[model samples]
Target chain A: MKKILIGIIVVLLLAGCSGGEQVQSKPQDQGYVFNYNGIPIVVNTDVEPVLKELGEPLDYFEAESCAFQGLDKTYYYSGFELTTYPKDNTDYISSVYFMDDSVSTAEGIYIGSSVDDVLEAYGEDYTGGENAYIYTKGDSSLIIITENDEVISITYQALVEGLN
Target chain B: MKKILINITCIVLAVLFLAFLQKLFMPKYMSSIYEGNLIEEYYDSDKDHDVIFIGDCEVFSNVSPIVLWEKYGITSYIRGSAQQLVWQSYYLFEETLKYEKPDVVVFNVLAMKYNEPQKEAYNRLTLDGMKLSKSKIDAIRASMLEEESLITYLFPILRYHSRWSELTWEDFRYLFNKRKVSHNGYLMRSDTKPVTVVPEGRKLPDYSFGENAWYYLDKMTKLARENGIELMLIKSPSIYPYWYEEWDEQIAQYAKENDLLYVNFLPLADQMNIDYSKDTYDGGLHMNLAGAEKFTAYLGKILKENYNLEDRRGDTKLAAVWQDKVEFYEWMKQDQAMEMEKYGYLKSYGAAAQAIIN
Candidate 1:
């Protein structure tokens, strides 16, 4: 009889343990959903609604440049500048340029992130000069522009072969 | 006396050798990337044109000079290249006036979207094809990037010196005389990549053309007026690149202020029978030969009715030139079609945009 009572208590404990496992099996918090038209808004994403999701920019205006002739308008946020095609400021966004550490990517990579952090997040399969680290996966790339081993800015463009 | 003769001979040999090298190194563009040959081919023309079109690929690929010649007797040449900027147009217009000032100068307003130099490669395509002159020098000054050197423009060997290994048989054959790549500045491709979905233009905070673009447009207007040429601003029927109403209004307002004729062809695409799917080759970005002819037919009517361009098909000299061009056009269309049939794609005709989304 005592053996039976002990077996019942063990069964109740197992049931309690299984109940706790359900909480652990709950869905994980997803990363930032940066996308437009199935193509990840990434760095060079130049469309709408994604801009709205990024929220209001800190500053926006036309950028002056001798070399950069196309996509004249820019939306300056805490950590990035979202540039658009034409200085008219109303068009498909051409390029999204990350500026500082104020904004973090879903992977926690930011402006001031260390090179080690990038390698840790994007893996070791990346190519660029010492000052620039490009982590490309298929057509989308997370290009980390650096200064003194720290990421200065992040730009995502289609790393199209032969375009450069 | 012997030493002097030897030195003179050496100098001549050196000049000939350098010229030969320059020719070899120059982009043949015969097999691939034919757009590279566009700007330089302008000088090859007879320079007798009733209308001179100046803009980017939007003007070159969209407007067919042959269609204009065949239908309206419009002898036209487009001094166009890929992503040509406004200042480049102004300079090209200036250089063009030096050769032949046509009765009508059609400037595509799309180039005005770019206020500054875009790329060295594109700049080379537009500026390198010119004969050495003050206009070329000024264009180089205005259009060059900071990293770009003017010496490369003067001596093309520097830019293409690395092309030594890339020399092909086409390079040798076309060294002295280049086969006409364009039909009087019309690059032809008969393929079609229909527009499945038209791109919608997003909202912009501003619609004003930049100060530099405005400055160049003003200069072009003044230059055209001085040369007794009527400058016509047109937004060609490119189904993509989304010509916004706000931009249209701005151009319209500018046209109103300056008393110039500005025609936005997006609205009239339907009336012009431009069904983007059937008409455009690479979707809606640019029209195929069918679309160009359709658009050109519509434009010819306008040029005749408004611009009062005379029919030059009656002129023997012009007709002789145009007849050959027409034959070449038919040949190019057939050749492209055959190429598509053989390779399942167009290797020539600048790859004819496999599928340019933007």
Candidate 2:
């Protein structure tokens, strides 16, 4: 009986401690994943493998990261842009931005789509003002900007834990 | 009665031991990542300044208070840190008003983009060195992330307890006495990594600033007015992170409505003789010592003409104090130049030094 009581107390202590654990979403989680040429591009994951799969980009730019010792690189594609942040000498995908209406999100929402279309596609589970709508799944967020009831920009961003 | 006295003595010793451990575990910021020590360095200053520059790394790495004093006889100090949020800047400004009231307060608008709390590491860099006060407490409350707790900041050992395994010689050496890192809150880097390719700003989903950021900015403006100080807004000349036209318009509109002086230095870089090829340290993000000198010289002239600030160099007492500062500034410049010449990179500043120590 005493052993069981001690076991319960230990379990309780662990459960209490687990309250502070942050939920960092993994790429395999049920978040929005952008597919390019049959290769799945996931934010917050290694960008090298995806780059290898996607082939060469139209243009590439890199700069020394702010307040840290690493390079922030961006790869421009035909319809979208892939940006990465450096950590431990490895580049991780931080965001993917759509440049034009040629490409749409996996949910069929693209630039020029009406606000009502976005509400129907992603549903009412969003947060933001009339100018922007943010749909978050785990730590990844799908940000959409609208002007005059038409979508103007679409971006998929990985919500990094620390300074980005 | 004897038992009770012994118990009390034991409790007191335990408390003292924990306090000592707390001091030991906290980062000394003596060697590398010197920006973390910028806040505490201000407490040791004379607190007599005509201008106070406040914001994130944009102000600390870009502007030089030493240059302002040497060239224009305008006394100034930069209360800046790495990725300092707008609310933290507001609280820091509130705290500064308690020590001294400057004629003008220049705020960099780069930090306005961040509406919520950023990294815990950055919060520590901005808040850890601050003395215990109401402003510090409020800043902690305003800046705490989801994983952060008030008690952890109150007793930093609670948060840094894991650092017991990572304690270094510098941590022990500077546990009691910390080395001065910044000159009037301006961290100097002599090396230059000139701008090669300037990247354009990405299309944002929303160009409008968050309500939380605006709330703090409004508070800052009102606080400056209440204290009888002129609030000047500036967008430092950082080529990256793309300051969009829409963002600039909003700030311009705000400045116009508030009747504040808003200067966007990115466009005026050429006018100020800021050559990106020779001026910047880490590409085009921040200015090296040479770049900072040029910018400060130009800014000092405008400040003098606009605010009618008197050149305080004529005052013998002020000149003597600044004389020591100028000498220290020159010494550090020479020291950095020698380091760059010998090692081809800074051995005492930035991540290279940290890597060597580790």
Candidate 3:
């Protein structure tokens, strides 16, 4: 009777361990929702949020160094292109881009969409030339480029000065 | 007599051993880190170039000197490396002028974006292979990152000493010499990774090139002008870095003020017959062989018509030299194609698995 009781308890513990694994399963990519501080790294957010999320970048180029790359301060992160600006003693993200497709926007803008898909997703509030499409919403904008009718790159930028 | 003989023998052997060690310790740039080999290869050249290009990889990977020579009879070389800074170019031009006086010196405008020193790794790629001189010394001083030291640049053994354990057969085989890694200064990629995505340039808070960068451009312009060398500034047609209007305006203004010719090729992609989807090797960051040939052919016409460059194909000595280069170029083209087919990535050419993955 004692042996039978012990085996029953062992089976119960094994069942309990696996039952927890199934509930804890989550998506492999969490949609690249990187936050710097608590600002969510969205448009109109300051640079502090980036430091909050990623802490200090591994390397940085000053404004003079970055002027050649057409950036102010190009911050190197793990698989992220983050640029920031300083105005009135405050730092804020000027632009953010990803070379990979794992990251996406809430509106579903991604690396391989068509020119028409962009207009449909973001509405017609866009201005473009032969090679570019700039979709503006308030002070935030999504710059998309389409080559051969396929969206090749997408970037997010805030259209405000670093400091007021 | 015996003591004197032994001492002399010891001195000779020690010099030879140090020479061997120096060769081993230097970057092979053969299997991997191809950019590292680029600047050093110029030393092996006959140094008989008519036009010498100095800039970043955009100039090296985009333009073909063999094609220029074959089609235009213009002997040219590109002294380009990865992320070559403005001061680095200024210094490289200074170094190149010491060897041969090329009538035309081309500066790729892409490097104008960088005014200050970039990464130490990139600095080493551009500066290390250079034969030690005042130019090399200046380049080291201007390009060194804060953590880098001049001593290491002077004696590369100290910088690369850690690589002792990671040495491979390439080091042993090329101890005395190196394989001709470039045709003139062009690193070839016969394979294609089409531009699937055209990235838009983000608006910058400030679009002007930095004052220090302008300082180098002024120095370059002044140097070229003083030397009576015609300087042509070109913006190659790699689409991903996204050449901006603001930057273009500034470059154009600078060109006009200096009475220099500046060609922004991004707008002329249509005229060049450049199909980004088919032409680029690394998704528009660089051009493959087909793209490079087309760009070179078009630019050669401009060089012939506008720059009044001589076509030297009829010169027997030059022809003999070029024929050898053409043979090597064909062999590399075939080799790269075979490697691509066999490995799906450039395995033999040292393309890391990450090369295709990204």
Measured by TM-score, the strongest candidate is 2
Compared with the true structure, what per-residue lDDT tens digits does model 3 show for residues A59-132? 66432111111224567665456777543345556677755566656667677888788888877766866657
lDDT of 1 by residue, B152-267 (tens): 67877656665567677888888888778888777787887777644334323245677999999999999988888999999999856667777788899889998999899988
Q: List the candidate 2 regions with Cα displacement exceeding 4 Å.
A: A1-30, A64-69, A87-89, A101-104, A107-125, A131-133, A146-151, A162-164, B1-5, B351-358
Q: Which segments of model 3 are wrong by more than 4 Å?
A: A1-164, B1-19, B350-358
TM-score of every candidate: 0.70, 0.89, 0.69
Highest DockQ, which number? 2
lDDT of 2 at B179: 75
Candidate 1 segments exceeding 4 Å error: A1-164, B203-205, B350-358
Q: lDDT score of model 1?
A: 0.71
User: Which 10-residue window of candidate 3 chain B scores lowest in summed lDDT?
Assistant: B349-358
The TM-score of candidate 1's chain A against the true chain A comes to 0.56
TM-score of 2: 0.89
Better of 1 and 2 by lDDT: 2
**Residue-by-residue lDDT tens digits, candidate 2, B240-353:** 668889999999999999999999999999899999999988778888899888888888888888888888999999999999999999999999999999999899876321
The order by descending TM-score is 2, 1, 3
Better of 2 and 3 by TM-score: 2
